[model samples]
Target: MPKDTDFLYVSARIKYLETKLLGKNDIERILDAPGPDEALKLLNDTEYGYDIAEMENIYEFEQVLDKSMLRTIRTLKESFENHELITFFTLKNDFHNLKVIIKSMILGKDNGYLSRLAEISPEEIKKYAEGERAANIPDSLKAAYHKAMGAYELTKDPQRIDFALDQALFDEMGKIASTSRDPFLREYLTALSDLTNIKTMLRLKKIDGDIRTLDNALVNGGSLPKEFFKEMFLESSQSLIEALESTPYHQIIDEGITQWESTGSPSVFEKLIDNFMISLARRGLYKPFGSETVIGYLAARENEIKLLRIIMVGKINGISSDMIRERLRDVYV
Candidate 1:
């Protein structure tokens, strides 16, 4: 457990940083931008101004975003005294970069495209990937990675690889949090676990994923019933809603099912769930004394970037603000 003094300091820092997140109007402005260059002008008006100005095109926008985020994450980690905390923060990029590489190779795209992948130093990730040093992975992580890697080999489906690796990393994160003395960190992990489980269940139900397959995918420790997840395969979307009626996510799942019925597209439902999760995290950050603030800030920052990217794309495609708003994730004013 970290000392009380350290927690207080970190929380204070997080509180100050939370003020930097993009507001709702910022998103609307980006969506309303006339074109990519005009969108670039809006970005230039923000703290990310310099990064946007340097980008030669929209493709470079992603690179600049990656660099900025990684720089921010590293800056945050530098404030921590614990090597464990720093390492945990660093691994966020490790898994992300690896996934980028895996997906790029599968698509036969230029690996150089990853040069601007999530904000961790690309050079560092490349060094780690190329180095002969053994991974400093925990025993639990090593086992899960081995399983996911094996699953990757057995099924060439990138989605499978993504899910397998996702479950693996999350399980390992849980294992680490379990040993931490910080209540805020534990609570953050618990919230994350719940969100992940809910999202997985929704997607699995949509695909009518098999019972055994759902069982494998369902992470432990969420509010969802393992039995319900197993049986979710035997039911339809409506049945899933009925089964989850007692849970916090029941209404969410129901709303998604309803939208699916009306729009004949699941994108609305997907965006709703995403926005709900973001809203949940944003609300949780009011706590001024613990890791929730830290984790919440990180989550908010990532979503802010995601929202910008979404609006940037919408601008490039000349999509209407109404259409883009439908896809925007929730953001605090």
Candidate 2:
């Protein structure tokens, strides 16, 4: 844990920034906006206004959001003494950019959006992906790139790239969480791994994927044993629900299962889990000072961006308010 004094300045800045986040009412107004232009107008009164005002098209909104995220991360990095804690929040973007670059090369097209949100430059990642090795790139990421490329070469399967990089991402996150020795960070990462494993299992089962594929897809260092999920793979959905009942995610899983049974759609499960994660992230607000506040602020900002994307897309596509609301995740504020 960091000393309270260490977070004094950063926490105050984060708290003030939190006030500018979109509340439920702001979200509703945005949702109820008559058109994409109207919705974009609504943002002018909020922190996103400046970014959205000069946008040429709806698709360009992603750039605005990404810029906001990069700005926030940069601000935190500049303000905070404990840079490692801030790095934890941005590492996923680095891994994501790596995945995009690798996949784009394999596909022979520029399908990737190189995010500035990452700690590492996209050009450096592109160089690494193009068969040039960099001394500055993390060894684990380098290993992941080589392994993923090797897998793709052997199997000629493009999806292997994503699988390899995702595994590496989780492994790196677990290492960072352990090094930090922050219980909240550890638990949060553990839950993420567990939920990821669960989601992967459920998705593979839905597709009748082979046991080998399922086994390879599972990430380690989560709260549950690998064998536990493997054993549950043979069980029915009800049994899966029962098995999860004793875990921290019992309620969310149970509700998701019930919804799945009724609707025969996995989206309910995804939404429930997302809400659960957001709820956990929101708990960081209770602490006046610590890495939790920083982590929570980042998570909240990310979710806020996600919500904006969903709402804007829906408005642009003429989707109904009710449908958009159903897709909206829980607001941090």
Candidate 3:
């Protein structure tokens, strides 16, 4: 493992970049803007101004958001010499493209707008799917491709493909974190895995989904055992919450599940889980030097982009600022 001192130069530079991040106030200003144009003009004063200008209109916010994400990925790739850490951080998009390409092949539709983050072309995945070797794609993705394809063939269910790929994603994340040599990053991934599993369990129960589906949907790498969820699979939400009583997630689960029980929707807990992860990600910010800073900054960038999308969607649709504010997630800055 590299010593903290080894990261001094990169960490210092990241700290300076962190200062330029949009604060809660900046987000609120955009949220409070009278309409879409006003809200966009407010964003124009920030770092996204240049990208927004390139957009034909404010409704193209998703493109601008994607540009922001691309810039962040590019910036981190350029700034950090630790390619493994960067790869681990950005691996989700690669998996996302895998899902798209595989599904598109199944449906005979276009594989649209895959991110260039992985540098592994769509044709590479297609060739590998056809039993030809493609070296550009990661071994993990190649394995996931086979698993998802087989699962889809067996059940003819697109969701089985999602289940297979999602578990592969976390399993691969666990593999990376195990070798990452950063204890907190591993724990961070664990928290995410746990939360995802928890949500899957609660969601399945809410919709009266089969226990076997929950079994297939749950991923490893979380601290809690898979059997831990299976034990309470047939129980009430309260029972599930009680099963989690001694864990750190009890409160969030308590609140999120309670709301979900009443709302007939998963959005509340979904938001809470995101909030929980961002708070967890904040631990990386205080580290003087390490991969932690890189991880923390990347988490901030993701949070910012997510929140911007929420605000923009609400703004363009004529949703009021108060309503939009309610939908906004906590800002990292």
Candidate 4:
């Protein structure tokens, strides 16, 4: 196909697939469903689950998502024939699986602890973690792993591993977005960077952390100017409040502060930040000719899997569905 024709065909296919995405009503129904099994049933019957032979249980539901995600990637890769785009999406998944293994190994967590990870081959992840030299991994992943290892060294705290992994991933994603030729993808990247930086700042503030740590953790490449960071550092919580008053993140930050005050917990704000990022991914899908659509779709799928896992854990613990739903993430669809 001609170069121009390729995008035409792929975009057409994407449009058709987009139409099949779960609607707001679908999510509401899932939310109201009596149990995880019922939610799984609803998902199984969707166009996204054509290959799902059965989803009578949580495991099967997870299996269907795994298969669907891989199938989605295969479809995109086949349709686009854009090596950079394919590699970008594949690398994102690679980084996810890599972080899971590394964190598990470092924490002395077993394979069973990793059961919720996508159906990526455990053997492959193990081989890469064990055999591949740090320098030999993809540049983005290598940087992330190295930073993660550094974070581990900093506190010897296992929870810090995830924080470091996220910071590193943000850095790499920003770089990819800045270097991409697509303007729409670049904007998506900027939005992602802005959200990431906001989250990092909030986390640091909650922990009463210092500027050095914040600088180390902050992912660059957003439209948010350098002045914003300087202002953030100088401002008190109230001043920071004023600074963010006009920004997209204002409401999220305000809610976080309120939650921090009422419950003596920062977790709510953190969840809000995560939900915002997921929302960004969902919005990214509407833009054409950019990495946003692919990244957004992948992020959405991953969140779905995570939501199900949370529900599964809740079921195992006999927690109420309301509690489980509270912990559940906003669906990107």
Q: Which candidate has the top score in lDDT?
A: 2
Per-residue lDDT tens digits for candidate 3, residues 251-279, read: 88899988887977778788888888888
The best candidate in terms of TM-score:
2
**What order do candidates take by lDDT, descending?**
2, 3, 1, 4
What would the per-residue lDDT of candidate 2 be over residues 1-333, giving only the tens digit for each residue? 677678888998999889999999999999999888888888888887788888998778788888788788888888887777777778888888888888888788887677778878888878877767754687877888888888789888887777787888888888888887888888788888999999888888888887777777888769898898889888898898888888988987788778876887887788888888888889778888877888888889989999999999998889999998988988999
Candidate 3 lands at a TM-score of 0.94
> Considering only N, C-alpha and C atoms within 3 Å, which residue pairs clash in candidate 2?
none
lDDT of 1 by residue, 1-333 (tens): 766466577678777777766787777777777777777787776668878777776767777777778666766677666545434444555566666655555567744345343334554444434442354434443454456557767876666666776776666566667666566556556655665666676667667666666666766545455775666656677787887788666667788778877877778777776676676666537776655555666677778888888877777778887888888888853
Which model, 1 or 4, shows the larger TM-score? 1
In model 1, the runs with Cα more than 4 Å from the true position are: 82-92, 100-145, 153-159
- Every model: Cα RMSD to truth: 3.5, 1.5, 1.9, 4.2
* Minimal lDDT window, size 10, model 2: 129-138
Cα TM-score of candidate 4: 0.77
